[model samples]
Target chain A: MDGIIEKAISLRFEIAAVILFGIGFINLLLQSNLIKKIVAFNVMDSSVFLFLASQGYIEGRMAPIVTNGVTDAANYVNPIPAGLVLTGIVVSVSVSAFFLALVQRLYKHYHTVDFDEIMMLAKERVE
Target chain B: MKKDMWKRFSAWVNGTSEERGPLELPDTAVHHEKKKLFELSDEQKIRLFKAGYLAVAAVVCLAVVSVLLYTVFQLPLFGDPNNPAVNDVVERYVEKGLEETGAVNMVAGMIIDYRSFDNFVESSVLFLAVTSVMMLLLRDKNNISREEDIQEEHERIIEKEASDLILQKVVSMVLPCIMLFGVYVVLNGHISPGGGFSGGAVMGAGLILYASAFGTDKVRELFNMKTFKTVTSTALLCYAASKAYSFYTGANGLHTGIPLGTPGAIFSSGLILVLDICVGMVVACTMYGFYVLFARGEI
Candidate 1:
C-alpha cells in the first residue's frame, strides 16, 4: 500500500495522462458524431505526448539546450523523447487532416454527420 | 436450367415488377398492419442491441483503464536519473552531439543527424498524404467548368467585400516578416529550438494568410500546383541523396572527413542545415497543398 502510494505520488503526471487517455477513449466509443471522435483522437494523441514527455523529466535539470558552458549529462533532461514527440506531432497533424478529408467526403455522400445513420443508409443501398 | 432458376430467384429477391405486381395483397389493411408490427419489433431489437453493445464497451474501457493504472505502478518513477531512459545513449547525445553534429541544439542534432532516416521517411509520409488527399478531392476542371466560373465569381465578390483596407494593409505589412522568420528558424535550427517542421508550418501559415486576404489567384500567381510538385519532389530527392551518402560512408566505415564546421554558425552543421531547408520546403508545400485542395478541390 505504501509503495503504491509512493508510485502514484511520484508518477502523478503519468496518472493524469492515463486519466486523459481514459476520457478520450470513452468519448471515442460513446460519441456518435464523427467530428467528436476526431476530437477524442486528438485528445488521446496529446495524452500520449504528455506521457512520453513526462518520462524524460529529471529532478532539477534544464531543457536539453546546451547553455553557454554546460555540457554535463546531469544538466539536461533526455532529448530523445522530445524529438520523438516532435515527429509524432507532425504525424498526428497529417493523420487528422486526412481523416477530416475523409469525413468531408462521407458528409457529401450521405448528407448527414451521424455515423449510425450513415451505416443504415449504406445498408439500405446494399439491400 | 440451373442458371435460369438462379436468375428468377435473384429477380424475385430484387423485387421484380412482374412478381410484385402479381402478388399484390387483396387485403391491404391486413398487410399494412403486419408490416407495422415487424417494423416496431425490428426497431426495438436494434435499440436493445445498441444498449448491450454500449454496456460491453463500457466494461472493456473500465478494464483497460484498470490494467493501465496497475501497470503504471510497475514503471520507473518520474524524474529519476537512474531510469533506463536516461541511459548511455542519451548521455552520449548530450555530450558528443555538439562536436559530432556541430549543432548547438541537441534535439535538432539528434533529429537531423542521429535519426535523420526517420525524419526523411516522415517527410515522405507527409508528401504522400498530400498526394492522397489531392487524388481524393481534386475535381476535373472540364466537368466543373460552369461551376468553377460561378465559384470564381462568388470568391471574387467575397474577397472584395471581406478584405478590408486595414486587413489588406496589415497582412501585406506582416507577411514578409512571417516568411523571413520562417526562413530564419530553418537556417538557425542548429542553434535554437526551432527547426524544419515548425519553420515550414509558419511559412505555410503565411501563405495561407496571403491566400485568404488577397485571394487564391494572387497566391497561385506565386505558388501553384507546378511549384508545389517541383519544390516538394526536388527537396525530398535531395534530402534522401544526402542522407544516403552519409549512411553509406558510415556503414562502410570509410572516414569521410567532412568537417563539422564551427558550432553556432549558420553553416556549421554540414548537412543538417541543408536537410532542414529541404524538410521545411516539403512541410510548407504539404500544408499549403492540403489547404488549397480542401478549400477549392484543386490547386
Candidate 2:
C-alpha cells in the first residue's frame, strides 16, 4: 500500500494520463451526441500522446536538438518518442477531420446528431 | 431446370413464394396506431436500459483506470536517464544524427531521413482526409435542394456585404507576418525546433483567418479547388519519388549522391529540407481545404 502511494506520487503524470483516458472513455461510452463522441475520442488520443511524451523525458536534459554541436546521448531526451508523438498527432488530426466530415453528412441526412434518433430514423427509412 | 431451381431458392429466401406472394411493408397508419400502445412501455424500457448502460460503463471505466494506474506503478520512475527507453537507439540518433542526416534537429532528422516513408504516408493521410471530407460534404446540385440553394445564396450575400472591417484590418496586418513565419519554420525545420507539420498548420490557420474575414470568394481567387488539388498531388508525388529513390539506393548500397550539406546551414540535411517543403505544402493545402470545404462547402 505504501509502495503504491509512493509510486503514484512520483509517477504523477502517468497517473493523470490514465485518469484522462478513463474520462475520455466514459464520455465516449455515455455521450449520445456524435460531436461530443468525437471530442471524447480526441481526448483519449491526447492522453495517449501525453503518456508517450512523458516516457521520453529525462531530468536536466535539453530537447533533442544539436545545439552548440553537442552530440552526447546524455545531453538530450529520447528523440524517438518525439518522432512517434508527431506521427500520433498527425494521425489523430486526420481521424478527427474524417469523423467530423462523417458526422456532418449524418446531420445533413437525419437533421440530428443524436445517435439514438439517427438509429430510429434509419430503421424507419428501411421499413 | 437450373434457372427454375435458382428462382425458387431466391423466392424461398425472400419469402416471396406463391404461398406468401411477397413480403409487405407494414402500413404506416396501422404502425402509428400500434406504436401508441407500445410507446409508453418502450420509452420506459429505453430509460431503464440507458441507466443500466451508464452504470455498466462507469464500472468498466473505473476498472480500466485502476488497472492502468496499477501498471503505472510497476513502471520505472519518470524522467530517469537510466530508464530502458533511453536505449542504444537514442545513443545512435543523438550522436550520429548530425553527421549522418546533417540536420541539427535530431527528431526531424530521425523522422524525415531514417523513416522517410512513414512521414510520406503521414502527409498522404492528411491529403486523403481532406479528399474524403470534400467528397462527403462538398455541396453539389445532386444533393442540394432548392431551399438550401436559396439559403446558401443569402449567406454568401451577407458574407460579402458585412465582412467585418476590424477582422479584415487585423488579418491584413498580421497575415504577411504569419505566412513569413510559416515559411521560415519550414525552411529552417532541419536547424530548429519547428518543422513541416507545425509550420504548415500555421500557414493554414492564416489562410483560414483570411477567408473568414474577407469571405471565401476573395480567398478563392488565390487558392481555388484547382490550385489545391494541383499543389497536394504534386507535393505528394515529389515526396514519394524522392523517398523511394533514396530508399532504393540505400538498400542496395549504391551512392545516393545527395549532399548532406554543412550542419546548421539553411540548405543542410540532404533531403530533409526538400521533403519538409513538400510535406508543408501538402499539410497547408489540406488544412486550408478542410476549412474552406467545411465553411462554404466548396473548394
Candidate 3:
C-alpha cells in the first residue's frame, strides 16, 4: 500500500484521468438524457487523451516541434502520442457529431430526448 | 322570443352552450382492477430494476476505476525518458523527421508525412460524419412537415428582421481577422504547431460566426450545398492522390521528384504543406456544413 501510494503520487495525472474516466462512465450509465450521454462520452475520450499525453511527457523536454534545427531525439517528448491523441480527438469529434445527429433524429421522431422514454415509445409503437 | 331563440341557436352552433352532463366514459373499473393486478407491480419492478441497475453501475464503475488506478501504479513513472514507449520508432521520428519530412513541427511531419494514410482516413471520417448527419437531418420535401416548413419560414423572417446591430458590427471587424488568422495557421502549419485540423476548425468557426451574424442565406450565397460538396470532395481526392503517390514511390524505392525544400521555411516540407491545405479546406467546409445543416436543416 505504501508503494502504491508512492507510485500514485508520482502518477497523479494518470490517477486524475482514471477518476475522470470513472466519472464519465458512471454518468454515461446513469444519465437518461441523450445529450448528457454524449457529453459523458466526450469526457471519457478526453480522459483517454489525457492519459496518453501524460505518458508522452518527458521531464525537461520540449514539445515535438524541432526548434533551431535541433533534431536530437532526447530534446523532445514522444511525438507518437501527440499524433495518436490528434487522431483520437478527430475520431471522437466525428463520433460525437454522428451521435448528436442521431439524437436529433430521435428527438424529431419521438419528440423527446430521454433515452428510456424513446425506448418505451418505440416499444409502444411496435406493440 | 324569436331573437332569443336565434341567439340560443347561434350559441349552440358555436359550441358556447353550457348546459351539458358529465362525459359518458366506458367502465374504467376493469382497467383500474387490471392496473391494480399488474401495472402497480410492474411499475414497482421497473423502479426497483432501475435503482438496482444504477447501484450496480456505480459499483462496477468504482471497481473499474480502482483497477485502472492500480494499473497506473504498476506502469512506469510519469515523464520518465527511459519508459518503454520512448522506443526506436519515436527516436527515429524525432531525430530524422525534420530532414525526411521537412516539417519543423514534428507532429505535423509524423502525421501528414510519415502516417499520412491515417490522417487521410481521419479526414474521411469527418467527411463521412457530416454526410451521415446531412442524410439524417437535411430538410427536404419528403421529411419536412407543413408545420415545420412554416416554422422555418417564420424563423428566417425573424432572423432577417432582428439582426443585432452590435453582432453585425463586431463580427464584421472580427470576421476578417479570424479568416486571416485561420489562413495564417493553415499556411504556417508546417513551420508551427498549428496544422490542418486545428486551423481548419478555426476557419470553420469564423464561417459559423459570419453565418450566425449575417444569417444562413448570406452564407449560402457563397457556400451552398454544391460548394460544400465540391470543396470537400476535391480536397479529399487531392489528399488521397498525393498520399497514394508518395506511398507508391516509397514502396518502389523510386524518386517521386518532389522536392523537400529546406525545413522551417513557409513553403517547404514537400507535400506536407499541400496536404495540410487540402485537409484544412475539407475540415473548414465540414465544420461550416455541420453548423448550417444543424441550424437550418439545409446546406
TM-score of each: 0.89, 0.91, 0.92
lDDT of 2 by residue, B1-299 (tens): 34445766898899878774322535785466556757777789989999999999999999999999888888899898988999998899899999999999999999999888889889988988998898888998656777668988998999978889899899999999999999999999999988899999999999998988898999899999899989999999999999999989999999999999889999888999999999999989999988888877898
After TM-score superposition, the amount by which residue B214's alpha carbon in candidate 1 deviates from its true location, in angstroms, is 1.6
Worst 10 residues of 3 chain A by lDDT: A1-10
Classified by CAPRI criteria, candidate 1 counts as medium
TM-score for model 2?
0.91
Please state the interface RMSD for every predicted structure, separated by commas: 1.2, 0.8, 0.8
**Model 3 off-target regions past 4 Å?**
A1-3, B1-28
Query: RMSD to native for every prediction?
Result: 6.4, 8.4, 10.0
Best candidate according to TM-score:
3
Highest lDDT scorer = 3
Task: Tell me the lDDT of candidate 2.
Answer: 0.90
Flag clash pairs in model 3.
Answer: none
Measured with C-alpha atoms, the lDDT of residue B94 in candidate 2 is 93
lDDT of 2 by residue, A1-127 (tens): 9977887887988888999999999999999999999999999999999999999999999999988888989899999989999999999999999999999889888999999999889988998
Which residue pairs in candidate 1 have backbone atoms (N, alpha carbon, C) closer than 3 angstroms, thus clashing? none
